[model samples]
Target: MRKNTFNIFSFDTTIRNPQRNIDFLQIIDKIDGKVLNEKSLLIYWYEAIGKGIYRPQNINAEIRNKLLKGESLSESEIKRIMQDNPQKVQNGFEGRAITHFKALHSQLLLIYDSQSKVVRISKLGRELLNHPYDVQNIYTKILLGIHFGSPIRKENNRARVFLNTIFVIDLLKREWGKLEKESKGILRHECVFVLGIKDCDYTKCVSEILTYREMYGLKENREYIENYCVSNDLKHLKYDTIKTYVDEVFRKFAMSGLIIARHNYYDFSSFESKKIEAILQHYKDYTFMEFSDIYEYIDFAYNITLPWIENNEVRKQIATQKAKELHISLQDLDFNDLTLLENKLNQTFYQQALKSKIEVSQIDTLLNELRILASGAQEKSSLDNIPEPLRLEYLLALILGKKYGSKNLESNLIYNENGEPLSYAPAGKADLLYENFSFEATMIKNRNQQLNSETTSVARHFYESKKQNTLEQRAMLIAPYIHWDVALFFKFCAKEFDSKLAPISISSFITLIEKSATFSEFSTNFDRLFVDKLLRDKTDAYVDSVNFVR
Candidate 1:
């Protein structure tokens, strides 16, 4: 019998900041075989965070004495801690279940050998580590793929609940059997107070949400939800925690372009709705796997169910949903073939690629998104309350990938479960690497900060990228507003080193649409004119590096 009988949905509260999760993954990935016990992980994590960074006077007497007396304290170690200034609060993090186990809760890492209690990063976790500059696609997939009983959650073994939650949300809002859903979308309040927490069955959850909708109406705020949470005492999460669950965990979930969370109501983005559609056939494959041993649990929970990992129950739901949509009998389609569902998804995505629009409207959308970020507006078409720096980094990756097909470039941003970019990179890598060229982007709008922080960082990235591939090497920096002096500083660096290190402003990036008829056309033209030209003449690389976009 499952200890956690009721399906209580939870995205780890600690995963609120995805960059922190990425940092945790990196520390672990560096370990031998990327494996370790939770106890060892805590000590390693504590040291890596430099948790005792406070000066000897500022530190508590006992802890400081223990360290100073037994260990030879070096001035360099203290200086390093002060210089790093780890700002993430570590109040009781040391004892909080390897609190950063947010990575495991997120499915980024997994308990590879459950018997030995060996924790290791997952395949997806390694991908995230490999690509720390951008994660929109990967993270978004993870968010949508998360289920009520996903083994990826904080407590996988004890829980026995089942639901393809994203599928459920889509079903609740999307038209079905030619009939509109009661709410037409999941309310923010519904997400916080109900959904996976109240019930594992999507149908039952829908009824529950509909009941709430009738009482609270279409628009309900956090206070209203908090009130209901206090009254019900469902699963006993604090009222404050309810707010964090909505604002942080769920906000990250919606950052995926697939989910439009504007107006405080979550629905499928009309354009990206096909993403849900593509996966619709696998909804029933989401189920809780019952395992007797470590190997069995890993095998079944991770693969056997995916009928999609341990992948079989969600396909049943998708088949039913498909039947309703087609207005056909359930007997009409072959729901039993798991391969059919996977193929259906693959077909939808292949169609998605062929459906790419080069129309002016495509650029119009990208440009508009950029403007919203630069103005620092709270309101937008879809994403909100997400970190602006991560958003900027994501947007730049998208823009560059658009200009030069993804096959040509790789980004270095890390993602959360929602597949949204959260951090730029680890210590020494550039934000983007494309055909021997490096591109770095920052959200720092202040000119002074750029001069202090970015000048040396940008130079370092350029040199690192160059060392990897010496051919036709160059680097580009992007920001909302590039300082003239900073641009000139790069120009001086260009003369001293490689001359192609340059910066471009967001304002200039906005004009990208006007300059190019289409993304492919822009890629072709740039490749032929600019990128190809440098290869012909070594002296051409000696030109000034400053783009002067202030």
Candidate 2:
């Protein structure tokens, strides 16, 4: 007789006479209202068995050890055990494990006695022992439960108990599948990547991996698949195919409510509009007009503004409420009446801004300073003969010195043999250094390089400077433009540098300085704007960077 194979659900146990007296419905009823789905039912059943709440006669010591030690037995050990115990092996267990294992099998009978404290298998758990492939549906259902099931439900909690079991089973199935050897290798690499194994094959591409990890939740581990073609040197997996796979996964995640779908124009339902209004209410103390300006300027009209407008019924109610507050009749409410509510809201926001020390006079001063800088930028062509990088460095030095009263602003900075200039006092420390602040500038005209070496070099300078200088001192990277590749490299540097360095496009830096000078507000708003560019929406950044590059 052929030796039986072992699987995730398999167990070794002695058989006993069938227990016809057991009440299956009553046992299920005891779990009713608790097991919400098929996944939950499976979990509850597995847990009860694992805890010895259910014990079959002559349970295999190996299976008992696995449960106690939280380890899985090897296939060889399972086969050896089966070969050593011929008397305990049923006729069905004499063959290799099947590809798919269903829930119900003839050799195993679920036994639960009302008077007993434990539930056990009547003919032992022999039927529980089968090939993992035979149970693909069961494992997939369990995975769905673990990924999508609500934790408040006992069923979900139950499903979690079998998470490891399903993981192992799934791995086994993937290994045993009919996929080509190269495909199998790719899957193995992916598994290692997801586990965050330090020595994984994809570790060579750490920068890309880190960027993908940040953009999408690290739990997805789809980065491995995304980089598969490039990493594995496989030409058949075309870019289009990879893109389709990624898009499909993203769509699935969006459907499951794990993430919002990326869209140009969000079609807001009535409920969604109300939800947005509630969200806006949370930021009611912010500068309403400025906030709206920033939102619209970034072209987030569809993504952010429309989502916050109240539904028709809610708008009508708001109009009526405003009319009542103004001591007017409901019939008197018109489009202008709607403006009353908006004005009232803006008034509250303005009051809050005033409390926060934002004064009209300060804003006017900052606006004037911005105009001066813009004029200077347009008129100054004296440094045009210098290399782009050196010119940018000198320009930033001048701007920072003018703004912050730094004495380090000089046009004729020293240059090294490589044509890279020592723009500031300390060589290679930064291109521009002011009081408690360091700036590094990179202005590359070419985009032919696969990797943005200039961006990486400047980022490295920023990182080293921050380490040598006080961690609290502001370190900024000034770049003419940040294309997609450079943006990804920046993200990588952010992770490696502990997020201490900020990337500032020339345009954004100018805008931020203008805002800060005009509003008399803290320059930390630049950090907020940088974050918005990175994570919220990239429309403004993309447009600005494209024009700058051109």
Candidate 3:
């Protein structure tokens, strides 16, 4: 029987750029074992090809029978049969047979002539036929060639860079796993749909490839395929046909386990979670450390693990059960206490032994070194300079101190017996401290420098002083000009400080001090008055009235 041939020119327009054709093969390779059994197709084609050169009239019948019988024909027997049946050769074309032949031919499994006279299996087809079960490595090589190989030409002198197939596959698998279910469905459907119709015509092939390319964020490849179609004058494929093809491919992939398909959705399920997590780790901004720095350790222990835990009733309950473990009171557990705990946990035995041996003989030298360190260290309050709008804080502090017989305060750096500096301890409560009243000063100048020294000083004092034995009776923020934005910021900080720090304008503070007869009365009505003033129509106008530069 004469081999059937279609007009190669009709489909030449479909794959105008050879690169797009290669890209299609790569898509196939990605789904080889999972979506389609390339080996089954290879075996069927191999046996059919060995049974003599097939024409459209005899190709399908010959292959179907052999497949059903589970039979294989040797090369010599096929040649002998062909020689005996010379009269059976007839010239004609069959559409279904031609479609099947063209599909395999496009994939480079077979070669055919336009005259419908000759059809032969390719070398790759023969290799796949012979080693069908163990052809993964060979299949991978073929796929990589399709993905990276370019036709050689004299005019093109540019270099071509190719990503490693294994690397590309690994990256794609991980990225595929990360995609949401809907995205995975879209990608799977589009890829399969395009490849199914790729051999139909040049325009249909380009449309499918372009559709899939757009979905994958491959703009450069999409543009190349689109330009190729336009330059080649290929007729566009109908939208309905493309949609039908996509649905069909989606169904096939669903059955193959490349993706988990539901009623209307799909998700990638082929990758290992451990491998995917490993890949994801490379993209994270922070890493988990087993032994953190001293500051971070303190933050984790205090803020994260045991915040508000010190000097609490909970310690008494702990003392009843595990009193031996409770070496010190919770109130006395400062940085030095925590450092010693960490050292006991993390320091190796040899390191502790060496340290002890050196410390016994060099105690005086250590004391002198610590004294030098303490003399070199000095703690500066954030409110020291008092920048513009913040300079208003100094005025507020001065006014409060003068009117209430309070004092302007600073933080004092505490030192150990050896004279090494410990934590910075505040000298008194906030910027101004009266008998039981604490007043903080804040100034807002620029948006970036919203919270200056005075603001932080007040916040710190309010947080710490409220925890004292006498307990702070009241705390207030004194700002000359509080922009609406700055006020909102204070509102946020208020939550962090347990709402102890009431932000009030300097003008409001002065008015309250002048009107209230006693400190108790001032504290009782301060919040209500501050809220009334903050919410008044004149608040924005008040911000505008202030001489910010001065």
Which prediction has the highest lDDT against the true structure? 1
Off by over 4 Å in 2: 1-388, 407-412, 415-427, 448-451, 518-522, 535-550
lDDT of 3 at 8: 8
Q: Give the TM-scores of the predictions, in the order they appear.
A: 0.51, 0.27, 0.23
- The model with the greater lDDT, 1 or 3, is 1
Better of 1 and 2 by lDDT: 1
- Candidate 3 residue-wise lDDT at 203: 38
Tens-place lDDT per residue, model 1, 142-168, is 554454444344342232222345655
Predictions ranked by TM-score, top down? 1, 2, 3
Q: What are the per-model C-alpha RMSD values against the true structure? A: 11.5, 31.2, 33.8
lDDT per residue as tens, model 3, 1-550: 1122111011222222222222223222322333113343333334333322231222345643442222455555444443443432242112322344444444444344435424455455454444442232233233322211122111111111111212222344444445531232233333322333212132344344445554655333444444443444333344444344444433322221123343343343222122223323432232222322322322221232121135334333323222223233445433434435422322222122222233333323333332222221123322222222222333343333334333222212221111111122233435445556676654332333345544566666666776773653556666544455555555555556545445655455555666666555666667566533444435454344321222
Q: Model 1 — TM-score against the truth?
A: 0.51
Better of 2 and 3 by TM-score: 2
> Which ranges in model 3 have alpha carbons more than 4 Å from their true place?
1-90, 93-99, 113-118, 135-141, 147-235, 244-269, 272-550
